[model samples]
Target: MCIAVFLWQAHPLYPLFLLRNRDEYPSRPTEPVAWWDNGEILGGRDGLAGGTWLACSRSGKIAFVTNVAEVGKVPEPKSRGDLPVRFLESKKNPTEFAEEVVMEAHQYNGFNLILVDLSSKSMIYVTNRPKDEKALVSEVPPGIHVLSTASLDTPWPKAVRLRTNFEKFLEKHGSGELPAEEMADKLMTDATKADKTMLPGIYSVEFEHSLSSIFVEANTDQGRYGTRSISAVSVKTSGEVAFYEKYLEEESWIEHTASYVMEQTGTG
Candidate 1:
């Protein structure tokens, strides 16, 4: 996912509210949110890598991955998508799992991963970006946070706007049982409401228009690039989970919805 804003324990009624936008070439193949045959995990699948950028286990575990934007970084053999899938498959607490991943983080391209354990109301964020001070397991503080094709909370224009808008969304709609459609609209915006002078620094000239907006669409010589999918997830304290997704197919966004009750397998 390119841009994501997750509210952990920020709402009184909902413990988790996650909104993310995955950007890629329009031709890239992907499947909308759905449970695998085993019916334990739920999220859209990356057809090319057979992994997922974001997913939630029935036990209230959540994982999210985002690429680090930089130049001349060597690509790793392991796909970043595997990070989320692997976390969902493991039973380790977020701290243990994040620390273990840091040991082998060099094996993958630069990435930022968020692992959450709802049973214990804990979250861990880890990244392998050389620019960061050092790799370590850090707890995700309560309240609003943003992640994009950069370090976590990097304050990229889109990230800042989304975070601000998300807070306003919650404040206007109230913290209780949020309107998923309104939440989805908060992410569907194409407005690039940022200072023009800061554009070149935030994004390359070619990708400025595309990457500046919360919802992107930049057609350049490189390829037809834009936001491919928008997903909104709300997990209630009572274990009622609601997931809504819209995938850009051709020229329109096809919508899909799913509801699952989180089964407390065990405490993290």
Candidate 2:
């Protein structure tokens, strides 16, 4: 369980969309996304053996999450990574996907995800706000969006801060051409800040800011990890879409891209 990226908006062709980063220990169980030897779509597996999680489908459908709440009293559900490969590989509609998961919340632990369908152009946020609030979701708007605890377009304090900082770059460039690798130094500013989430000492890893430079771009992948530049947002004019991405060393970032199955496809 690590980080997630999503957006809800009113747009043409596609609306609801998600790009998540599922970070975890290298030994936690997971799998990679392979376009079957015969070209059959098997998608990928999350936690198959320290597997990493990230995904989106050809249908523009996508989903991902981090452990917001662990359901210990309820048999601890299966795993969030396991969901995308299932959802991505299938051609289910956005509403059906959301409803299906809503009915089976107990099967997984605390997590948040945005499911979008390029065909129908629908977006929904499936989130269990810890034990304090009930699971909730809603529609998103057009244009690039950044989400963490809420549908916020800004940074929060901890690990997500790095993502938030990237948003600032989005506004600065007014486009996605601002080389991420070059801006790795900016992450040092975010890491040096206070740790609001208190998850771990990820903030202290500022020395690795150079790596952040490489995989700063975000998008959907099957089952991967780390900062992925999956589909670079190029050709940002009207009636155009583009992106590029790559996974991490422990093999987490790599799996995230291949996770997307049926629901994900090339952007318009």
- The lDDT leader among the candidates is 1
- Global Cα RMSD, each model: 2.2, 7.7
Candidate 1 weakest lDDT stretch, 10 residues: 200-209
Global CA lDDT of candidate 2, please? 0.44
Task: List the candidates' TM-scores in order.
Answer: 0.92, 0.60
The residue-by-residue lDDT of candidate 1 on 173-257, one tens digit each, is: 7855778767777565555645655663544655564577888777878788878988888888888888889888888879888
Error of 2 at 175 (Å): 4.5
Cα distance off (Å), candidate 1, residue 202? 7.1
Off by over 4 Å in 2: 6-20, 29-44, 47-52, 69-73, 130-135, 147-155, 175-190, 193-246, 250-268
